[model samples]
Target: MAFFTRLFRPARASERRFSELVGPHIETMYRMAWHWTRNTHDAEDLVQDVLIRIVNRLDELEAADKPQPWLIRVLYYRYVDLYRRRQRSPVLPAEDCAETGFAAEAESSVMDKPDRLALAAQLERALTSLSDDHRDVVLMHDLEGFTTAEIAGVFGISEGTVKSRLHRAREKLKGKLHGSF
Candidate 1:
């Protein structure tokens, strides 16, 4: 059994290191995944798939200066891949995501306020109305607090382009929300 133990040691070490390197970013990954997927089950599956894909790339991940952007980029690509796959073959109907669900989770502490819930629901609707690229930029920069440079890096776009997208996204959101309030 010593031979088997020796054979698996590297795998064990790799798993430990992957957990250490990845644990800190799981919540961020989940949040981004949730933003893209809009369903809890899909979000969890996306995160899991990303993690599985990256398990063999722990060396590159470890060498990164900041892993969050790298991780988010990978997650974004995986989401895009799944999106494209779904486009090619419409196996499942898109979920009718509750407009209030996203906002409700964010405003859990203030659930008693009807105005807050209403605003949250409206914001959710407005968010869903934005195009995918614009919505991503808005969520990463405005909501997740990632800087424009980081987002540009993730998407392989220029900082100016990211800023432009963000501006356009915010303007669209404002227009959608203007009549609601």
Candidate 2:
């Protein structure tokens, strides 16, 4: 009984510490997950997966200088893994799924403007056409405001590569939206 009690105490403490560190960021995690998944249920699952995976790494999370970036990096890798797994399985692609009405839920003033809405839809379609790497870089830098260096760190690539990918992605978008402007 003493041995079992000793074994379980640290696990419980670690879980408590993990919750303390991660609880405040749950909303942020969900938002980032939703941005990538664009589906409420999938986003929730993704955040839950990240939380479960990182709980065992409480030491690392506690020692990190910036927990938010660390959390985002973990989220990114998990998203990539899930993305690849879905690719291998014979299932409906995320894009083919029906819209989750996020766009409609946008600022009503913006939604009411047909021209802006059409342009937004065009841009989204063009984004979907890019390769995953390109799209991820573009979204991280242009949309999410992450620095190129930060993105490179997250992707485990060189900063130059991140810049190149961002540039190419923008060029591709421009080509796709040539007449829309």
Candidate 3:
């Protein structure tokens, strides 16, 4: 009876603990998801799905943990899943996506104007052209400004590898943006 009761109502203290500990990082989770998806709509959907998983997986987290790395792990795995599904399909008709209620208009767009939008589109193209390792490292570390150590933790790669990827990615972005590639 005590076990069931505890299960039903996780100690009030635990909720407080989780919020105090991980709440601040929740925005990072959303940004991580958004970066991976490349569109606001898909990012929001991805983050929403991850939110459910994070809630379910909270118990697996050690007490007094930072929760950022674990949250990145969730986002990374989900992005992998999403990347696979995208490769298999390659394209989804607008009607199908809308009919299935799988998309959100609020989060999905390429710029709305011509000149500025063109540059943004070019930037996205450059980003997608990168290898996954480089793209992930750059997204988390350079664009989002995660520390070398934090990025290493997020990608399960060495700090050396993260630094290497960031340097290479910067070179690549420069060439691509300058039309020198």
Candidate 4:
């Protein structure tokens, strides 16, 4: 009995520690996931997937002092994997997408402030127009307030590449928004 108890004690303690460390960042992770997925259901699914991955790799995460970037990196990679998988699959018919109601919600959300909402919609369109790499860099650095170094870390690239991507992304956004305004 003593041996069995001793063997399980550390595992339980580690699980508790993991939860404590990760609990505070759940909302942030969900927001980031939502930005990437652009829908509540997909965002929740993505966050759930990320949490599962983190829990599975809890041993490796024990040494991580700051887990936000690590968590974001996991989320980003998961999104990319899903994106690739989606590309390989056949597109669903329009009827299949009717249940999501994403378009109706989007339109209603913007109805309150016509000018600002229009501009925001334009910006979202521009963002979606960007290549995935450029869009990720821009979103991480600008909207999420991550530094170039941190963005590089998240993407596993150098700071110079991050800066270059960010610069080009901003230029592309500027061109897209210029015509709108």
Candidate 5:
């Protein structure tokens, strides 16, 4: 409607100053953050902080037509900084993990206390015991549903490298899961 247009008609002058145009990109940003952070609370906080920065720097961006790379670059830097900060801080125990939906499963537990349940829990335990880099690859590729290409972009690596890393990670996970099986 004309009313909506009028409300958003203020900053449409510059190609890069289109601040109101970010509404459609929030989900993608959150997905990127989630892929990087792995933890739900950290992902949500990272997305919110990135959005605030984007809003403040909307007019400063050199490329408006394709903001994805720029946005993702910010996310990558933030994630790295967050990683460093986490290393310097005390880690929370699993029992102390906030109910931030990180460990929640919405599916019905049709295999309650079944052999499959024990094996699955053992596999999860195995995964939680992997190195940080190995865990990151699995989380980004398998858990967060990101393509190898997108992960390469996030990690500033080539798609081939991403695939190789993912393959190695999978091999390790397979061993752990098979050991439990």
Candidate 6:
């Protein structure tokens, strides 16, 4: 019995350590996934896929000094792969816009703040108009509060490229918003 217990103890310890490392970042992963997928179900699926990959590669990930960036990089790549696969598939007829429901909810919450709703709508339009790469940098750096260096790390690009993308994205956003207001 002691021998069996000793054999299982390391496995249990590793499981606990993996949980400790991953538990805190689940929400962050979900948020990033949500932004990429723009649908709750898809975002949840993406995060689950990421978590499964992380579990399978736990031995590899265990050695990283900071796992968050690495995990995010995994999430981003998974999303890109999924996006590519989706693009290759035959297109189905368009579904009703989910943003309508979100906008309705936002409208209800800000009944007394019409200006805020208009601003949010405008911003959403502006964001949607940008190319995916530009939107990603802007969302990660400006909305999600990731540093430029962190964004560079996640995208596996140089810091200067991240800065350039961010600058161009912001400039485009400014132009769009400037015209709207």
The reply for model 4, stretches above 4 Å from the true place, is: 1-16, 89-110
Model 1, range 27-128, lDDT digits (tens) per residue? 888889889888777887898888879988988999988889999999999999998898899587667556345676857766888788788889988998
Q: Write the per-residue lDDT of candidate 2 for residues 40-103, one digit (tens) a residue.
A: 7788789878877987898899998767768889998999899889879987754626554445
Task: Give the residue spans of candidate 3 off by over 4 A.
Answer: 1-13, 59-65, 85-122
Model 3 Cα RMSD, 1 decimal? 8.0
Which ten residues in a row are the worst by lDDT in model 2? 1-10
TM-scores, all models, native as reference:
0.83, 0.73, 0.64, 0.75, 0.59, 0.81
Candidate 6 stretches greater than 4 Å from native: 1-12, 91-96, 100-108
Against the reference, the lDDT scores of all candidates come to 0.84, 0.77, 0.67, 0.75, 0.63, 0.79
lDDT of 1 at 86: 89
What's model 2's overall lDDT? 0.77
Better of 2 and 4 by TM-score: 4
Model 5: per-residue Cα lDDT over 1-181, one tens digit each:
2322333345445423454465445566676675456566667788667666666676554454456555666777887887788778798524325432322331136346466555555665666767766666677778656777777776788889878888888888888777665
lDDT of 4 by residue, 39-123 (tens): 7678777877777777878766767657878788888899889978877889842333432332334666767767766676787
Report model 6's TM-score to 2 decimal places: 0.81
By lDDT: ranked, best first? 1, 6, 2, 4, 3, 5
Model 2: residues with Cα > 4 Å off, grouped in runs: 1-28, 87-96, 100-109
Q: Which ten residues in a row have the lowest lDDT in candidate 1?
A: 1-10
Residues 1-181, model 3: lDDT tens digits? 1211232333577665655555566667766776666555676677667766666455776542556777787788888897788779958624323421112322246335455556656677788788978888888876666788888887788899889999999899888889833
- On lDDT, the stronger of 1 and 4 is 1
